[model samples]
Each structure stands twice: as structure tokens, then as C-alpha cells.
Target: MANVDQDSNLDGATEGSSNANAPLKRNSDDPGWNCGTLCDPLNKDAIKCKLCGFICKAGITRLKYHVSGLKGNGVAICKNASKEDKAVCVALLENPKEDKIAKRKREEEMRAEVEIEVEDNEFYAGSKKKRRSNLRPLDKFTNPINPEGPFLNMRQQNLLDALSKERTHSVHQFCARWMYESGVPFHSIDNDAFEKFVEAVGQYGRGYCPPSQYLLREPLLKEEVERTKGLLKKQEEESACNGCSVMIDGWTDRKRRSIMNFCVNSKEGTTFHSSIECSTDSHTGQFIFDYVDKCIEDVGAQNVIQVVTDNAANNLAAAKLLIEKRPNMFWTSCAAYTIDLMLEAIGKEGKFKEWIAKAKNLTIFIYAHHWTLALMRKFTKCKDIVRPGVTRFATTFLTLQSLMEKQEKLKTYVY
Candidate 1:
């Protein structure tokens, strides 16, 4: 009997040992188990990474860190893990609790929707009619349904509630001040792209950083160029359908380099074709003719209806050459330039020449002295004496007109 009892005790001990050595069964939904396997049956914390084949002594969290390729977590990252797998692990690590809460909320909402739909179907199928309320239809005027507007989701409502008039005004003032300080054009705020950019920034919420200078100059610039090309292509197609006018103009930049701009104008709009630097080449008829011919070729000679240029001798010669080559297209002088020449001739007259010289001297003197300028502004109520125009000669006449209009104020200030 003692031998049989000893045998039963040994059998129970062996069964208990086997149970202790059994592998732990983890939750099937755990993402950590997908990337690793149990290294030891008894030790639940020990896991072998399938990616790098490294055995980690820590728990599932450490195994996730390894799969996520995160450093400084007392575990080596999985070198063999792909970017997609690493991203999954990183997202899980960052917002595990938030993800769970969101999932639960979504499930509850779906269940509620299904219940409401079922109830609606049953109510519609039933023979009984809906009960009439005690309140009259006219009573709705006093107690309106959603007087503010339609109902919004919780997140949208929160965002709208947070954006008060005062906060919006403050943000506007801050942006305006930055643009003013940076010398950005005031009209830039009116651009559709600027409005969209502001909308995008607002949508991103807080903790969003602006693009770096390198991105702005390189990638963003290239993207903008490509977009502009697409828009110009549409314009070019329209121009091809309805012939375009080729306009050429030359100007000296701040660096004293002569630049010739070629533009194509159609019923759609004007598109800048190209710019050629002519600092090395003389302003000869042959040079102008060659440049204009090249531009016409690029724009498709068949699409060009007319060539327009200033009334300069070289431009006239170039126009003649263009007419000879392309008899179909006409050559015309710029009306604005012709008017500017007439204004220049009038300014050079004896009577007007002296008057303009005196006016120019007076303006120079008043602008040169801060005290005089301030006094003039104080007397004129901040009105300026100079009036800019399209051309230099036109500007002179406009300035004279402005001075005449403020003559009484000037007299008062001078006294």
C-alpha cells in the first residue's frame, strides 16, 4: 500500500511539472505576437524576433520596440524589418490607448446606428400611427429647432467653438505684421493659393511646422514651375485656336543688363514666352530680328497674327524684316510707346522744360529734407506730391498735376 501511494504521489508531481513547463497562450488580437515567437515555454517575457532572429528577454513591449526600430529602449532594433512593418509598430507604440478608445467609440456608434435603423424599419411596418405632440405647429416659432444652424459632429463643433472672433483677429494681425515687416506685397494675401495655404495650415492643427528653406527653394519651386507650365499650356492651346500677337520690349535692369522680354497675347490672356539677355549683343536690327524670329518659331509661326514693338529705329527695321519673311502677319508699333514719345516731345519744349525742371528741383529738395517732408505731409494731411505713371515723361506731368492740386497746402506749409 505504501509503494502504490508513493507511485500516485510521483505521478501527480510529474503532471504538475508538465503544467509549469507549458507555453503561455497570449491574446490573439495582440499585434506584438505577429512579429515574434515565444523563446521559452515557461518565460512569457522571452520572445524571438522573426525579422532579425534575435531573442529578446523583455516582454511584448520590448519586442515592439525592436520591431519599431526605436533606439535608447535597452533593446536592439530589428535590422531586417521593412519600413512598413516598422511604421505599424511605431504607430501602435505611440497611441495604443487612443487607438483602443477610438475603436470602441466607432463600434458603439455603429451598433447604435444599426439599432436605430432596425427600430425605424419596425415602426414604419407597424399599423399604429405616430402619436401627435401636445405642442402646436405655431409653437415652433417660439422654440425653434436648431436656431444657430444644422448640427455638426463633436470634433467640428469643438474646432468652431475654439476659433473665436478675438482669436481670429489676433492671428490675422500677427500674419499681417510679419508680411509687412518682411516687405511682402500686400496684394499677395488676395491670391487664391495664399487662402488655400492658410486653410491647409489650419486643418493640420497645432504642433505643425512650416516647410524648410531647402524644400521651398528646391522641391516646392519645381512643383510650382510644373503647375505654372500646366496652366500656360492651356493658355497656349487657346492661343493656337485663336491667333496670338507677339509683343517684344527691352528694359535695363538694376544691374544695368539689357533684357528683352517676349510675350504672347491672345483673347485668353497674355503669357510671357521668354527673356533674352542682350548685354553682350548690340541693339542692331539684325540682332532684334533674329531674336524675334526665334520667338515666332517657338510660338509656331502659323499662330502669330501680328508683331508689336516700340517706335525705335532698330525696332522699325526689325519689323520690316519680319514683314518680309512672314507676309501673312502684320507688324505694328506699340500705341502706349507712341503716346510716351509724344509726351517726351511736349516735356522738351522751352516753356514746359523750365517749369518741369523747377518742379523736379522742388520735389527733390522737399524729399531730401525730413523736416520739410514731414511739414508738407502735416499741411497736406499726409498727401504726397509725387504721382507715378507708366512712363518717365508721363510721371513728370502727373507730378506737376499733383503739385498744382496741392498748391494751397504747399503755400501754407512753406510759410
Candidate 2:
């Protein structure tokens, strides 16, 4: 940046130029042009010095730059120009008042040039004229190119029809199909195309647009769960119910480690132990009880009704703490498991053991063997009630009942 000091004169003179011997003068016709010796007296409406061409535009206010003695691109020679040309050109470039006027004049000139080109092109579209026109009129009446009919191209229309047919399926599947088969050589999608696709997908993009999970997926989902839990906690706080209930169960996997499942019933949604936390170490009675306490504190348990669990001693022990904390808190053993236990106890007394063993074997054989159902159909006239696919929980008594009634041929296996 260049600095213009008030004490400096335009004729490469500085501090010494402000002497009495120096006087500034201006011509009546010129506005900013001046000739002068510095510190000269000036008439009203007089800005230039006739002697030195120094500008006194701002009344001694100077523009200070970071660098001293640095000059920008040099100004043009205007002394030889006619007064009118000088005035018009200099005013066009420098006057703040002429900005809008100059801009309008340039725009008018550009519009005229575009009109002439379009006329010439119409007269000679295929006669040595280029296929494309660069300068087209902006207004609707004069514009030569416009989309008059169908909005989508052939490929886009086909994709739209396919997606409409499979409206029940996910939008991602639709997009994936079109993106793979569009066959248009890979090129940048225009703004209109991209926006159209976004509009087509609509709200389906919320969960369907795959998130880049990487390592943070679990952490992010956990945060979401906690946020949902907070809303449930708010509901619990508002309710006046005297007690809440919890249920606990555990199972050992092929890895032989006990995994627990806990459910806390509240006015809010049922809170199930997610698979991620099921394998955590909370199997013992004390541990499970402590875990429940922590969960209560997490949700601010003040109005719990009762806790319920299977006939596990650990569950009973944990129920003790809840009774102590809230005297009204009650515990109930699961009746379904209790009945199964009673049946198991009675089965040990007589020939019922043989029947139980045979039932277990027959159920397992039909479930674990794939060809047993077909074999059973061949031997007897009795129709098999088992469904014609893999049974997800075929070993359960409910599913095994269908298999046991079929009289399926048994296939033995040695493990």
C-alpha cells in the first residue's frame, strides 16, 4: 500500500515545498486537475493546482500506507486530452456519483451485442454458424433455447417408472439400481438432476442413508439410547405410581459365560438389556441386585411398584434390598418357571422318566435332522403339522409338539 501525506506535493516535492514562495493555482475548466506549489491558497470549488497538478480533494487529510514512498500503478497522462474527454473519462473512472450510470450504460451495450448475434445466428443456423451460441438474450421472449416439454430425459424417466412400481421397497434400493445401470458415462450431475433426486427420496433419506459408522457407531447409538432413556426418566418423575417393576434372566452361550438380561418396566417404553450389555458380568445375586440399584439411580427411581424375577435365589436376594428401601416394594416369582419346576420334580417319580426321555429324543431328532419330515410322510398316513422350513426354535415345547405328533423317522448322529 502507498501512503499519501498531507505535507507532500504531487510533483515529487515534500516538507520544503510549503514555503511562502510556493503558491497553488487551478484552471477554471478543470475539476481535479491542478498545478501548484504546496500550501497555496485556493478559491471555493477549486481543487487542482495549475502550477503542479497536485490534488487538494480532502482538505489536507492524507492516506497513510504501511510502506513509505511506495506508489501504486501510475496514473495516465490526461494533460493533452480535450476538456470534455478528460472530464467524461476521469469522471467515469473516479466519480462515486457516476457508478450506477456507467453500469447501466455497459449493460445496454452488452444487450445490443447479444441481440445482433442472435439475429445473425437465426439467419444462418446451419450455414457455417457454430452449433452453440454464447451470447443469448436473458428475457423469456427473446431467449432462443428453452425446455418446452417433458422434464426428465429417457433414462431418468425409466428409473422413475421402475421406482414407482416398487414403491413399497426402500428408496436406497431404487437409487442403487438406477445409479448402477443408468449407463450414461460418468459425468458431473447437473444441479437440476441432483436436486430432483433429493426431492424424490424425500424423508426416506433420514434412516436409509447409510451412516459411516466406523469405530464410533456403537458410541453414537449408546448416546441415542441414553437420550431416549432421559425422556423415559422424565415421564417416571412425573408419575405418582408408588413402585416400579424389574425382571432378570440369564443364559450361558457356547462360550460358557453367563449373560444376563434385565428389563425395567416403566410408564415409558420397556427398557430391555441390549445385546451389547447382555454379556457383561452381572450374573450373581449380589451383582444383579447392585446392577438394578444402579439402573434405578440412573433413572431416578422414586415410585417403583414391584420387581419380579424367575425362581432364582439371587433374584430373591436382590428383591430384599428393594423391600428395605421402599417398604411397599414387593417381589413375585415367575409362575411359568415355577410350574415347569413342579413338573420336573414329579417326572422323577415313575415310568414318566422313560416317556420324557423318548419325547425329548423324538423332538430333537425331527428338529436337528432336515430329511426327517419327508421320511415321516412316507411311512404313515398321518400328516405332519411342522411347518415346511427351518424351525427357528424347534426345540421349544411349543414347536416340538408339531414335530412329535408327526412320527418322523429318526436319524442318529455321534458328536
Candidate 3:
């Protein structure tokens, strides 16, 4: 390639003073052109070698073999050709096939790039002149060269439709895989915000980059907080108009810290008011009363129709205090909590307790041995004899019920 460039410069420099007989026009695309020139203006078969001034009667292909020191061609090797010139000729002769393949690949890549650019422009601009100018050779079949010609044939239209469907399926698979791998809930797909997000991305087209972690955590988080505040404000207004109940629930978190949740329920919906960690404070009647009173004040005393709490001794004491303080508003025990307490008391009875203990021992034995557990599952058709529930007492009852339902299967397994 360097030799070719040097030869080109030499030709340009000597063009003015050169003999009129020297070939004026050069085939720049051919590497053999750098090694020699055509002997006659009209005869391409005869090449005059620059190195040895040997006029080969054969074509440039034979001249290249001669200059490169390759024998057996109809021409003699150029004795005056230097080693560097021989190497250049050898490389050019040997690599034409590989060079042609590489050139074709580059051309295909360039065509693909042009097609994508044209598609993007067509999608956005939709101008006839622009589309005509940018249309690929293959596209000319579907897209009319003249405005009077018919649009895409049925075959081409179907092909385009299939491609669009494939594109949509690919996008869907990408989104589904991300959600599945990331452990995002399936029901989140039904969320209005998620649907809108997909639509927004489609509208924005190809270059839509998702929000970074910092944006999601900082600015987006702050925006969502403000939006939630607005919704809560509306809920508060409804609560005031319709009258709401203040419901208190106490539970321990995974860290074993005692936490109390305060919620306000109205016809509109239930809104979580606040939560407080009471691990450091004693859960006395006074503490409960103070917290409930503060919640009532926050919700507005007139809007609070009732204060509902679990039927625990401290909660009962707090109810009495609330009744005395707010005589107009009612104080009540949670009915669900009362039922749970009844279930707990019934489970502790002698007969029920003994049955529960035996059931627990059977479950423990089966679960302890993998073989026993697998046998039980096979007999039960993969249904376990233990059924958990939301509450401890409810879970016990549910498990007992499951045992009764699976009694035949359990007997078969045991035998």
C-alpha cells in the first residue's frame, strides 16, 4: 500500500515532463498498476514493468506473478525487482481473495447502518423525498420508485408485519426476564404506572435509557413522597367529613422490637397514620392512653368516631381512660382480636391440647425424616397435613382441620 502511494506521487510529479507515450490514465483500484503501466494506450494485455522495463505480453495477473518471484508463468521473473517490491507484489497477489471478502463485509455493514438511519428518519419524518433518497436497493421493491406505482405487495406487507410482531415479542421477553430475575412481583405488571412506563418508552423510541439508581433513590423518591403527601391530604379531608376510626395494633418485628401501628379507617379507605417502636418503653395503660390520645388529636377529635384496640388488659385500661376523656366518642375492642383470644382459650383445653400435641409430634416426626415426609406427600397427593394461618391460634385450628381432611392419606402413609 505504501509503495502504491509512493508510485502515485511519482507519477504526479513526473507527469508534466514525462514522454507523451507514457500511459496517461491509471487504474487506481488495481495494485498491479503501481508495479507497471500498459505498453499501448489501447492494449491492456501488454504491461511494461517499471523495475526492469521488461514488457510482458501477458496481462497484469501474469506480470504480478513475474515481479513477485513466482515461477512457471509464461513470463520471466524481474531480476532487477528489489526484495521489498517482490514482497509488496506477493502480498497483493496472495491477499486479493481475503481483501475482496473483507471489502464485501464492510460494504454490507455500511448498508445495514444506512438502512437503520433511513428507517429512523422515515419513522420520524415520513417525507416522500427523504424516503426516496434513503431507500435501500431491496426497499425499492416494496417502496415505489415512482409515486404512481402501487405500495408494498401483500408478501412484503406480511413480512414487515411479522418483523414488527417479532420485535414486540423480543421487548416483552426482555422486560419479563428482568422482572423475574429481579424478583419483582407478577401483579406489579398490572399496575397503571408500569403500563404507562412501557407506553412512555415506546413513545420516546430507541434511545430511552432507564433511570439510574441515584435518580430512582433521590429525585424520583422525593417526587413520589410529595405525590403521596398530596393523596394523603385528600384522604384526611374525606376522613374528617365521613368520620373515621382509629385502629391500633401492636406486634414485634423480625428484629424482635415491639412496634405499634396506628391507622385511620373511613368509608374512603384505611390509611396508615404512623408507627412507633415501643421496645424501650413499658407497654403500660398510661403509655397506650397517651399514644391513642395523640393519634386522636392528629386525626382531629371531632372526626374520630371510635378508638379500637386489642382486648389485652393494658388496652382495656386505655379504653376506659379514652371513654372518660372523650365521652362522646366510643372506645371498642377489635372483634377479630376477641375471636382470636376465644380460639386460643379453646385450644388450651385438655382434650384439644392433647390432640394438638399429638398432631404436632406426628408432623415433627414426618418432617424430621425426609423419607417419611416424601411418603406422606405421595400418599396425600402433595398436600401437607399442616396449614398455616395469619394468627397463631388460627394456624393451630387450620392445621387440625388439614389433619382431619388428610386422615385417610395419613393412615395409608403410616401403614
* Cα-based TM-score, every candidate: 0.58, 0.40, 0.58
Give me the candidate number with maximum TM-score. Answer: 3
User: In model 2, which runs have C-alpha deviations exceeding 4 angstroms?
Assistant: 1-243, 267-269, 273-284, 346-354, 363-374, 377-396, 403-415
Return the lDDT, model 2, position 306. Answer: 64
Candidate topping lDDT: 1
Q: Which ten-residue region of model 1 has the weakest summed lDDT?
A: 151-160
**Could you give candidate 2's per-residue lDDT for residues 1-415 as a string of tens digits?**
1455533345334323543344443323333333222343534333443423544443211111001111352322424335554444445344644777886676545333432223332322225543332332322223222123232211112132233434323444555566679764445343344544454333121112234555357866888779877876655654445445666666677987666666766665566643224455656667777776776565446655666678877788877876787676677887666766765665666776676567667656755766765555554334554443322222234434554543222211110
The 0-to-1 C-alpha lDDT of every candidate, in the order given, reads 0.77, 0.48, 0.76
lDDT of 1 by residue, 1-415 (tens): 9999999899878866875665443434677788887877578888888888898887888888999998898899888999998998998898976888997686445333432122322221123554322333333223222313432211111122243565445456667887999999999986656654554444432222467788889998999999999988877898789889999999999999999999999988898989989999999998999999999999999899999999899998888888889899989989999999999999999999999999999999999999989989998779899999989989999999999977856866875
The superposed Cα distance between candidate 2 and the true structure at residue 314, in angstroms, equals 2.6
Clash numbers, per candidate: 0, 15, 0
Residue pairs with backbone atoms closer than 3 Å in model 3 (clashes): none
Cα RMSD, each candidate: 36.8, 39.9, 34.6
Residue range with the least summed lDDT across 10 consecutive positions in model 2: 60-69
Candidate 2 displacement at residue 219 in angstroms: 9.8
